[model samples]
Target: MIANPSDVRNLLESHYFLFAFLSSLGTLQIAVTGSGIRALWLTPYRRVTRWLGFVCIITGVLFFFGQPLFVDGPWAAGSVQADSTTRAWGVASWDELAGARNVNDIHGGLDGVDQAIWFSLAAIIAFSVSVVFGALSIKANTKELRVDAKLDDDDIDGLAGLVHRSYFSNLPISVRNFRLEARKFWRDGVRSADRWSLIKIISGGSNQ
Candidate 1:
């Protein structure tokens, strides 16, 4: 399905593109958590959800600095000049660009560093937008634990149910029956604990 894999590789190698991808994921996590929409959350644990967003932010920033942007002038004939910074570093000829374009007869496409740049500024735009959204998401979630508030209902029953169904929906009927039984047992234990705690509180009050 790929028309030009060389272009894809070059795009993927860009620090800006990596930042944008991670930032987008981070934003999505924050948006879902802050929106208090359990249906959209990736996991049942609010702490895990928040941690995922933070992880994304940290990951994006780390990747953004992994490589510096490379710049070269457009070709006029058989050669093009490198950018001022590049030229200052002693690379001024088009031979570097030509060598990059030389395809391998056996494997095909340019070697790792030779792939040409496409959509030069598009990655930057994506990275900037992702950073903005990630910041906004963090701001929105900072006022309150929106994800926790949403999960407070029946201790994240909805979120847990969603995960359980997604993973085991295709399993045999016997497994499904066992899952229901296990859930019932867990709920019974919770209720027993609550009752015992209430009883202890009344006994203590009576003694006082």
Candidate 2:
């Protein structure tokens, strides 16, 4: 069956970002992952990153507009899709998303596949931002790995953040893989930090 993007969009605005942010670590991952810190703004990938960032921001806005629709279908389509309370904010926004439909009695917006388009547009934006940043972070980590030098303490913090960002970038793309890497990053960070802490404690530093 064709997926209903409207439903998906609603989920995103309602609580998905909270999950995404917690699970993925947002933009910090990208900065830490890339050697582009050397020339981040002018890095070869910077141009692409900026555009994707723009798209990500736009997608967030689009989802804002499309939200009520999923919550409230247009009248022409049927009666209140939502309960009485949601009718206030939801119906108006739903009609607006439907694009100048006779919303007086029309509560529902575009029906069937049309309901999916707005959300799909948002998806395009989501993909660009998350994937672009995620990939860049991965490349940076790989580059560091190739060097085989332990990241300095500050760099380790950066790596921790980068791992989180990579987590987010991976969320929508491959949730399973994202979780795996996230576990690795968190566990590794803890182990590394613990080891350092132990050394410092032996040398008279705080034992944790």
Question: For model 2, how many clashes?
Answer: 11
Each prediction's RMSD over C-alphas, in Å, is 17.9, 12.8
Worst 10 residues of 2 by lDDT: 100-109
Question: What TM-score, computed on C-alpha atoms, does each candidate reach?
Answer: 0.32, 0.30
Over 4 Å off, model 1: 1-14, 68-208
TM-score of 1: 0.32
lDDT per residue (tens digit) for residues 1-208 in model 1: 2113444235335644456566766666677567554333445545677688779878887654432223321222232233211122212243454433222322233343332232234444544453454344434443444344532333334334322222122123435656787899899987667666866677773332
What TM-score does candidate 2 get on C-alpha atoms?
0.30
The C-alpha local distance difference test score for the whole of candidate 2 amounts to 0.42
Best by TM-score: 1
After superposition, the stretches of candidate 2 with alpha carbons farther than 4 Å from their true spots are 1-44, 66-208
